[model samples]
Target: MSKTKFMGSIGRIFIASFLLCLAVVVIYPLLWMVMNGFKSNGDMLSSPFSWPRELNWQNYVKAWNRGVSSYLTISILVTVTSTLTTILISAWAAYGLTRVAIPFNRLMTTLVLGGLMLAPAVALVPLVKLFQALGLYNTYWALLILYTAFRIPFCTFLIRSYMLDLPREVDEAAEMDGASPAATFWRVILPMCRPIIVSAVVLNVLFTWNEYLFAMVFTSGGDFQTLPVGLTSLMSKNGTDYPVVFAGMVIAAIPVVVLFFASQRYFIRGLADGMGK
Candidate 1:
């Protein structure tokens, strides 16, 4: 073989091997956690690496009955609401920033994108006070609002980048057909931006599902608790029931994992398209 062809083959082999190892590194811990959920405390302690001798489905039952069910529901609620809200607002903001002619457009873009730099930790104290004053503390609204607010900047950045690359002629065509701005956005732009929107939804859902600090702090436990905080609480209370704890973790992880895999195509494509733009 030619030298160039031989080097290309070597490169492909190296890349494939690296990706295979990376996949194993990422997937093994998740598989291990799932396996442990089917084990008893003794099995977990005795043979952490070995497969469970029997599938102790009772562990999952116990986890669900104890609190995972409620936490799962709350997480779903928050994730859905927040994801929808964030996407709508971000898409609209992106459309306005990219399409419409407005004064101080650069300033507006800067201000909106500037939010990405604001650390959530820095706002915790002020947010607590503000929420408490507004009678939103310890409420689902608090989580929904916080999740939407914090995520909007990044989502908008992504959608705006993607929108910038789209042909302006579509906007003109929609307008020539007597479509209103809102109609144009909804009918022409949104459908075209499906990849990025799906990507944003997946990302927001992952964040809302796994978010712990705000969930723990804003809600006073019980009904408002999301999966991450609830899982931590489960671990604390059932520290000895290793199987149950693992079960709760597995339950918490399943949705996001399923979601990413289901939308993997759109997710990767969206990010790639947006970044390339």
Candidate 2:
């Protein structure tokens, strides 16, 4: 091959090697967590890297009994509810902002985008008070609202950017056929925006699933604590049970990791479309 082609091929190999190494780095912790979850407390601390000669499935049972099972259910509820609302509300808002021209559209978009700049830490106090007054404090509703509100700006931005890349011809054609804006959005726009929607849904799932701060603060007690918050309490109460803690961590990670792998294609497509434009 010519020098140029040879250099290009070498670059490709280097990029592939870097990516493979990156994947290993990212996945190693998860692999270790899974392995340790099958180990006894002594084995976990004794040989952290080496595989066990005998698998101890009892760690998972102990972890489950020590609150992981309940925490997992709570995490699933919060993640699913928060993600669904975030996507629906944000997608509708984005489609409206991009397609429907109203007065001060730019100002509205800026205001919404400005939400992205505000740190959640700054709003935590007021959010707590607001939820308390609204009687939503320390409940799934509190978590759902907080997660949805916090996630809106990014989701709106992503969905809006993706919608911009969609062909305007589809909208015009739908309009010419006497389709209303709502119909056009639902029938024509939504289908085309599926990739971004999937990406947004997955992103929101990851966030809401793994969230600890808000879940810790907004929820004080009762049936309100999410997986992260619950896991912390579980760990504190069972600090000596290293295997159980590892198992709980693994359980907490499994759903989001599985969902990410399942939706990775659409996630990548959405990211590419949103960023490429």
Candidate 3:
């Protein structure tokens, strides 16, 4: 074989090996956690690495009865509401920034994108005061509002980047057909931006589902807790029930994992397309 061909083969082998190792590293812990959920506390303690002798589904039942069900419901509600709100607002903002000739366009873009710089931690104190005064504290609206607000900047940045790469002729064509600005956006641009929109939805869903800090702080426990915070509470309350805790965690992780895998093609393509621009 030629020297260049030999080196190319070596490079491909090296990359494949590296990726195999990375996949194992990422997947093992999740598999272990799932296995642990099927174990009893004693079994897990005795043989952390061994397969469960018998799949004890009772742990999952106990977890569900103990509060995982309620937490799961709340999480789904918040994730869905926040994701929809964030995407709609972000898509509109991106369309305006890219397609519309709004006043102070550059300044508007700067201010909207500038939100990425503001850390969520820094706003916690003021947000608490504001929410309490507005009677939104300890309510679902608080989570809904915060999740949408914080996520909009990043989502907008992604959609806007993707929109910027779209051909301006589409806009002109839509206008020539006597479509209004809103009609053009809905019919032409938004449809063309499907990849990025799906990407943004997946990303936002992941964030809203897994988000703990705001979920914990904004809502008092019981009915309002999301999966992350609820998992912590489950751990604390059931510290001795390790298997149940594991089960709760497994339950929490399943949706996001499934969602990502289901939409992975669009997710990767959207990110690549957006970033390429």
Candidate 4:
């Protein structure tokens, strides 16, 4: 073999090995958690790292029946509702910011970007009190609105950055054909923004799915509790049942994992586009 070819092959092998090690590091914990989920309580305690001799699949059924099913439903509702609303509202905001002439647009963009700088904990106390006074505290509306509010700034930032890259001619073309602004946005801009939209949807899904603190503090009762809060509550009640707890964690993870893989292509493209700006 040529010396250059030999060196390139060696470099490829080294990079492959490094990435394999990284993948193992990332995947092992998830695999371990899944394994533990199939163990009995006693097995989990005694042989935490070992594979179960006989898989106790009963924990999944128990966990699901006891709490996960209801909490999963709540999570699905909150996540889907908040994400959809955030995308729609943010899309419009983004389109307007990019397409329309507005005074102090730079200042407005900075203000929206500043939302990500504020810590949720710093605002939680006042927010809770505000919700309480508004009669939305401890209700789905409180959590839904809070989630949407916190997420909108980021979503607007994401969609707006991507929208800037789109050709302005499309909007102009639609207008020349007698399309209204709303019609142009819905029929022209929206269709072309599918990749970024998918990215926004997946990202928001990840945030709203994995979110815990807001759900815990804002919503109580099984009726309003999302999966993370309900799972934490389940851990409190079944502290000793490691298998059940792990099972609950695993089950809670499935949807987000499914979402990530389903939209993997667009998610990466969106991240690239967002970062490129």
Candidate 5:
């Protein structure tokens, strides 16, 4: 073989091996969690690495009955509401910044970008006080509003980048057909933005679903707490049962994992193209 061809093959092999190792590093802990969740506490303590002698599905049942079910519902509700609202508001903001001819547009854009710099930790104390003052504390709306508000800046940045790269001919063509600006945005631009929209939605879902601090602080425990907070509560209740605790974790993780895999293509493309362009 030619020297160049041989070098290229070696490079491909190296990249493939590196990716395989990375995948194993990411997936192994999940595998261990699943395996150990079925084992008895004694088995997990003594032979943690080994598969259970018998599958203990009851662990899942106990975990679910303990609050995983309610937690899952709360998580779903907050994730869906927050993701949709964040994407919609961000997409509209992006469209306005890219398509409109408003004064001080650059200043507005900078202000939106400034939100990305604010640390959630820094805002937590004031947010708690504000929510309590507004009587929104211990409510689902508290989480929904927090997730949407904090995420909009990053989402708008992604979408605005993607929108700036779009062909202008489509907008002109729609305008010649007498389409209003709102219609052009709703019907033409949004349809074309499917990849980034899906990407942003998936990203928002993962963030809101896994968020813990706000969920723990904003909501009084019980039906209102999301999966993360509820899972922590489960840990306290099942302090001695490691298997059951693991089962709760596995249950908590499945939805986000499914969402990521289902939209893996759009998620990667949206993030890459949104920034790359």
Candidate 6:
């Protein structure tokens, strides 16, 4: 083979090897967590790397009964509700910022993007006071509101970037046909924006599902705890029961893993166009 072609082949092989190692680094912990969940605490401590004595289904059952089920349900509700709202609100904001002839548009974009820079931890105390004042403390609404609000900036940025590349011809054609701006947005732009919408939804789902700080602080009651907080509580409650804790973790991880895998294609497609610019 030519020298250039031979070097290109070597480069490809080297890159592939690097990525394989990285994948193992990322995936092995998840495998270990799941595998260890099937083993007893004695087995975990004594022979950490060895196969389980048996699949300890009891661990899952115990964990589920000990608030994991309730925590999981609450997480699902918050994630679904907040993620859908975040996407809708962000989509409208993005569309308005992109399509509407609003004043101070540049300033608006800057403010929206600026949200990505703000630290959620920094606002915890103030947010706590505000929520308590609003009578939303220890409630689902606190978490739902926080999730939607924090995610809006990032989601709006992505959707707006994708929308910027959209052809104006369809919008103009719709306008000529006497469709109202809202109708055109609903029926026309939204349908065409599916890839990015899916991407934003999945991204928000993962965030809301895994988010701990807000969930922990906003909801004081056990009935309102999410997976991350619930898992922390589980660890404290069953401090010595490693298998049950691990089982709770596995339960917590399954939905996000399934979601990312299922929507990965659209997720990547959606981000690619926006991030490229």
TM-score list, all predictions: 0.97, 0.95, 0.97, 0.94, 0.96, 0.96
Judged by whole-model lDDT over C-alpha atoms, candidate 2 comes out at 0.87
Candidate 2 residue spans exceeding 4 A from truth: 237-239
| Candidate 3: 10-residue stretch with minimal lDDT | 231-240
lDDT of 5 at 227: 85
**If both were scored by TM-score, which would come out higher, candidate 4 or candidate 5?**
5
lDDT of each: 0.93, 0.87, 0.93, 0.89, 0.91, 0.91
Of 1 and 6, the candidate ahead on TM-score is: 1
Q: For candidate 2, write residues 1-277 as lDDT tens digits.
A: 8999999999999999999999999989889888888888788788989887678988888889988888888888888888889998998999888888898999999998888998999988998889889998888888888889889999999999999877889989999999999999889999999899999998888888888889999887777777888877765543577778888898888788889899999999999999677
Worst 10 residues of 1 by lDDT: 231-240
Backbone atom clashes (below 3 Å) for every candidate: 0, 0, 0, 0, 0, 0
Error of 2 at 1 (Å): 5.6
lDDT tens per residue, model 3, 165-230: 999999999999999999998899999999999999999998899888999899865469898988
Which stretches of candidate 1 lie above 4 Å from their native place?
A: 237-239
RMSD of each: 1.2, 1.6, 1.1, 1.7, 1.4, 1.4
lDDT of 1: 0.93
Residue range 93-153, candidate 5, lDDT tens digits? 9999998788899999999989999999999999999999998989888999999999999
